[model samples]
Each structure stands twice: as structure tokens, then as C-alpha cells.
Target: MKLLFLACLSPKTGNYTTAERIRSHIESAGHSCELRDVADFHSPSDLAHLVSQNPPFEGALAIHLFKAGRLLLDLRLPFGVIFGGTDINEDVKDEQKRVVMEQVLLKARFAVAFTEKLKEEAEFVLVSPDSKIYVQPQGIQTEVAEQFCWTEFLRSSEWHSKNLHNILIIIGPKVDPALTAEVEAVVKRATGVFLAQERSQQELHAAMKRCYAVVNSSVSEGMSAAILEAMDLRVPVLARNIPGNAAVVKHGVTGLLFSSPQEFVHQSQRLLSDQELRERVVRSGKLYVEEHHSVKQERETYQRLVDKLHKAQFLA
Candidate 1:
């Protein structure tokens, strides 16, 4: 199938937007796929003239739904939409944003929501009680993820290894200060990396392999790349207790969930102090992600949707 992938890609940093991954996955399946970073347009960049008019794409997959790119909702092409965090978490709460989001939802041949919670939220936003929304987890190539030796990372003076463990926190400029500061008290004493920017996919997987645990502190999210990647590497996750985080991490089995920073630190330290408990959570987390977030599974679902959409369009 010929496909045109559309989304804004953030380069010069380890920002792997979901749209890029879907494009890569589709291409690997022997389907022709081309990616255009629409956000880079109107500014001088190496990839200028990104796309003034939509290319002749048989299938157009829009990863983000925003006013800047809302034209896709009205385009003639049979499009697929992949929901990002902002579209649901923040935008849907606003009247104008909700309307645009709903418009995009209705235009899609099928909607791809990374989490079940998001699928539900999108349904409410669209008010199409019967919208065809697919709850597919973002796939991860665990085998190819970079593996690193993290002895030094564990040996820092603040890294209390005696009765503590390293728990990695992943986020970027998108994280709010209030939430970060609130969780700081819980994480300040923990031996972990509090990164303003996430590591590259390779570096991230490598780091996950070395760490005892991963933390999700997002006050709001759709489905987190950090939590899923940590699962791929078999790292235990201690995620914030929210719809987005809850949809991914199975409480008590995959990881502990908390609403506050104090709770995050408390649960984290508890998980660290118990080896057997940690192992159990990691084991469950690994199997859970591999089963649901596998690349092949998502491809099959997408193919089916595309095929169905083609038939419906022909019938009309």
C-alpha cells in the first residue's frame, strides 16, 4: 500500500514522536511510506517545502490533531489518526479544542489510541459512541535496544545503593513545574537520572536494562513512551496514578501507582527494599508489553483497517 505519514518530528533531541514510529513500522512491512514533518515548514530547515499541498498518498496517517494541521480532517484521502497526549489530555477539555478534536476523530477511517483510557476519552470527545477506535500500544524493538553498563550511574554519592535502587525518570520540556517539584521530595534522595530530555531509543533501552526501576511522573499523558520502553527492557515501573498511566501499568503486578510525589517516593523506596516483589512486577511488566505492544500485532490491525476503509470508500 502507498502511504504518506504526517506529523511534526522534533530532531536535534531524542524526540521520537509516535507518528515517526508508525511510518517506520509500515515501511518495514514492505508498504511504501514517506514521512513529512509539517511543523518544520514556514521556517528555514534542511527539509523545507515540507508539504504545501498533501502528496498523492493513498493512505494518510495523521499522528497529531491540531488546528495547524486540521486540514487533514477535510482532505479527500482516507486517513488514519494516531492520538497524541495533548489532543486528549489538555485540548479536549477546551470547547474549541474539543470541537476540532472531534472533527478529526470523525474524519478518520480508524482512530489509533495508544491506551484504552484514551480510546474511551476520544469516544466522549467525538460523541460518536460507535466510532471505530483501536486501542493499540506503541510497539518497541526490545532486541535492538542499546544495553549499557551502569555501575558508575549506581555509584554516585546520592546513589544510596545499600538499601536503595536506581529508578529512572523520563520527561522533557513538556513536564509541568508544579508536578515535578511536587514529586521532587519523593525522588530527590533516590539514585536515578532526572532528565530534562529523554535518551535516544538505543540509549534509553540501554539505561533501562541497567536500572532497577522507571518512574512516570506526568500529571497528564496519553500513553507514555517512557513507561512502555521501560516495560520492553523488563524494568519495573512506578507510575503516577492517572488514567493514562493506569491504562499501561497494571497496579501491583507491573508497577506501583501513586498520585503525589510523596506517594511516588514512598512506593519507589518500598519496591526497592523488596527484591522478590520487584522481580514479580518486572516479570509481569515484560510479558504484558510484549504481548500487547508488539510491532507485528499493530501492523496487522492497521492493515485490516486500511483494507476495510478501502472497501467502504469503494462501496460509496
Candidate 2:
């Protein structure tokens, strides 16, 4: 399959990570993928190219919000949207933001969200009830620590002196550091180190297994790749008590959640103290993540979605 994939191609964040990873997947399957960056882009931008030219693509994919995809509506191209968290969580709130998103979805042949909550939101908020919406968690390939030193993850922050106690917060653009500081302060009673704004998803996941727990302080997410990666690595998670995090945590089963800073601190202390409890959470979390969030399954589902859209558009 040949694909003219459209997304923000800049690095240093999750959007780029996702675009790069999936672009790799598509190429690995023997498809040709042309990636474009909207951030470094200009007006009458790729939008004009998509609208004016007859693309050699079977179907197109729009992977970012704002400028990358807003043009697809006018092009009337056969494309699918791989929605980012901001599109559903933040952009849907403002009237202007919502308008762009609505146009993107309405023009798309299908839309993919990484979680059930997000699928519901897409159905209710931006897309037609009949519009095809798919739920596929972002896939992760787990790496066990062998040659890599766990100390390297800790060395920079002097985390060993912090009692080998550290919390990892991997940030993208929408991540609120205010929430990060609050999470840090709450976990401080336990005397743990809180490291913010990690460089890569692989590094963050590796650290999740090394740390006692992983903390997700984001107020919103489309299904956090971090949360699933943490659960898969069996580190146990302490996350915000919100829809995106809640869909995975299982509340005291896999991990705990809290409404306020104090409550989060209370749960963190409880998990720290109870050895047997923490072990149970880790066991259940790992099992649950593998069963529900397999990358192999997700990619296959994605292939089927692409085939379906292609058939609907140009084949059938």
C-alpha cells in the first residue's frame, strides 16, 4: 500500500514519536509513506498540495491537529485521522478549536482514538454517529534491563541518595508542570525523587520498571502510552483520578488515584508501606496490560481499518 501520511514531523515530543513509530510500521509493511511537518510549514502550505494535486496515495492519514489536518476537509480526500490527546481533551473546548476538529472528523473516512473514553467522546462530540471510530492503544515494545544500568536513569538527579526512590513524569506539550509540582510535593512525604520532562518514551518506560512507581500528572490524555507502558513493565502506577488514567488504573486494583494532592500522597504512602499490596498491583497490572494492550493486535487492527477505508473509497 502507498500512503501519503500527513503529520507534524518535528522531534522532541510524543506527537513526533507516534508519527515516527507508525510511519515505521507502515513502511515496514512495504508501504511508501511521505511525512510532512506543519510546524516548519507555511500557508498555502501542504494544504494546497493536498487540495490541488492528485495524490498517488490509496488513502491519506492526518496525525496532528491545527494546520496539518485542517486542509483535508477542503480537499475532500479519502483520509483517516489518528487523533492526538489535545484534539479531544483541549481543542474541543474552545469554539474555534472545536470547529477545526469537527471539520477534520467530518471529512475523514474514519478516526482512531487510543482509548474507549476517547472513542465515546469522538462519537458524541465531533464525529457523526455513523462515522467509523476505532480504539487501538498505542503499542510499545518492552525492553528488559540487561546491559543498561538502572543507575544511569537515576545518576543525573542523585536519585540513589533519594533512597532509590523516584517518580518519572514524561511530558509532551500539554503536560501541566503545575500538576507535576503538586504530584512531586505529595510524593515528597515518602522522600522520593520526582524527575520531570524525560527525553524519550523508551527511557521513560525503562525508568518506570526501575522506579518504585510511575506517576502520571496530566489532567487529560487520549489514552496515555506512558500509563500502558508503566503497567506493562509492572512498575505499578500512581496517576490522576481522571477519565484517561482511570480507564487503565482499575482504582486500587492495578494502582491508586486521588482527587487532591493530599489524597494522592496518602495513597502513595499506603502503596509504599504495603509490600504484598504493591506486589499484587504489579502482577495484575502486567497481566492486564499484556492481555488488553498488545501492540501486535493493535497494528493488525489498524491494517484492517486502512483496508476497510480503502475499499470504501476506491476499491469497493
Candidate 3:
């Protein structure tokens, strides 16, 4: 079966990585899955034209409900949806987007949330039934560039650090500009802070491996892929205390959570000064990722979903 996978494909972002990973999973099951950036299509008509083009897609899957799943409505093909961070958390607060998302959920054959908290939120906010929603945590995988040097990276960025612990703060494209600017302002006051922007996955992984700790200051998340990747790479994480972050980071166990900018600084200092705490969390974090976010398990889950879709198609 040929499948069409639609997602926000911003360069060097989590959604793009996820779309690619799921595409690989579908393809591994002997299906041809075409990944297209959701930004390219403006309306349902645009998607209809693409679907009408050569060979046609037997099934479709979209990452974000309103952004991608909206296009799937009234289309002939069967489709599924995976909730994006903002759609469930921030976007639903808006009356218009909430209506659209509710419609999308109603029409979708299935929907996925990365965490159980998100699933419950979606069901409560969007009034979606439990039977339609599945909780499939994002899979974790990391590969550091063999030749990448931390010193060279710092040099390229014109950052000169003398034995100071390197703390990485990622600036994702989807984050609110005001919130991002505020977070940057606070984090930059600390020593050895690297504000990473538009880095390839390899570079991000390499930096995470060498950094003293990775920080997530986002106001909301759909299970941050970076936090999971940081854990998989054995890097300690310091995340903002949001429901999404809370779902993954068990305070002082998997990672530390901070409720404010001041707490983030305090936690950073504690993690850096206390080697025993750092080692314990890093070890437990890695073990957690291995047990809960394995690539093989993720692949199998999607494969099972695809097979179910295929069986439904055959019966139809």
C-alpha cells in the first residue's frame, strides 16, 4: 500500500524528525510512504490535487490535527492523526481552532498523543472519545558525529569558555517569539550557555553528549523529542515544569524540573556541583528511555496500526 504522511517539516525540528521516523516505519512494512511538508498545502483542494496525481495514496496520516488533518476531511482516503504540541495545549484554547480540531478528531479513524496526560487533555478539551485516541510516546534515538569537537563548535560560534560547564538551550522554530526571547534573556545570564539554532540532528546530538545539561524552557510540549534524546544520549535534562515535561521527567529521578527561571538556575548549579545526583539521574534516564521509548517498539506500534488500516481497506 502507498501512504501519504503529512507533517510540519521545519528544518532541524522535532516534528520533521518524527515524520521521517514514522515514514521509515511504514516503509519498512513494505508500503511506499511519501512524506510531504504540511506547510506546502493551503487547503483541502491543494491536497485533493496532490491525491489525484499519479498512482494515488491508499492511506494518509498527518502529525498535527488542525494543520494537517484539516486537509484530510472529506477526502476519499482513510487517514489518522497524531497530535502536535500546540494543537492540544495552546491552540485548543482558541475557539476557532478548537472547533476545527474537534471536527478533525471526529473524522479521523484514529488519533495519537505522545503522553497519557495529553491524551486525557485532548479527550477533555476536544470531547474526543477514548476509543479513538492512543498514547504512543515518542521514540528515542541519538547518534553523535564522530569528528565533531566541542571546542570547535564553541569556536565556530565565537563562544570562549574557560573550564565552565556548557549548558545548551535549544531555540525551536515553533516556540512563541516573546517566550523564546524571555527564556533566552534569562539563560544567557548564566555562564557557558550555548543558544543552539537551526542545527542538524547530528550536531544537536553531538552537543547534547558534551553539554553539562540540556534545558527545555518551552511553555508547552507534546513530549519533547529533544528531552528524550538527551536522556538517550546520557545527558542530564533541566526542563520547565509543564504538564508535558512533568509527564517524562520525574524530579530528581529521570531529570530535574524547574518552575521558574530562578529554580532553573538553582537546579543547574545543583546538577553541576553534585556528581552523585547527576550520575544517578543520567543512568536512570537512559534506562527509562531504553525501556519506554525504544525504536523497535515504536516501529512495531505503527506497523500494527498500518496493518489495521490495511485490513479495514480490504474489508471495504
Q: Report, for every candidate in turn, its global Cα lDDT versus the true structure.
A: 0.68, 0.70, 0.84
**Predicted candidate 1 versus true structure: per-residue lDDT over 1-316, tens digit per residue:** 5666767666522224566666666776666777777564432232223333354456567676663236565455677777888787887778887887777777677777787778777777666546578888777665435455554444455555443454354544433488657666666655555534544567656666766777777687777777877877888898889888898888889889998878887898789689988988989988888888887887777767667655654554
| Winning candidate number (TM-score) | 3
Q: Candidate 1 — which residues are off by over 4 angstroms?
A: 12-17, 41-55, 67-69, 144-198, 308-316
TM-score of candidate 2 against the unseen true structure:
0.81
lDDT of 3 by residue, 105-140 (tens): 997778888888888889889977789998888888
Model 2 clash pairs are none
* Candidate 2 lDDT over residue span 1-316, tens digit each: 5676777765555567677777777776666777777654455344655544555456678775555667566554578888787787878788897888777777677888888788887778774555577778887666654433444434444445656564443434434579657766775654334344444555555556667787887787767777777788888788898888888889888888887889988989999899988998899988888888777877787777667656766642
Superposition TM-score, candidate 1 onto the true structure: 0.79
Return whichever of 1 and 2 wins on lDDT: 2
TM-score of each predicted structure versus truth: 0.79, 0.81, 0.90
Error of 3 at 114 (Å): 0.8
| Residue 265 miss distance in model 1 (angstroms) | 2.1
Best model per lDDT: 3
Each model's Cα RMSD:
4.7, 4.3, 2.9
Which residue pairs clash within candidate 1? none
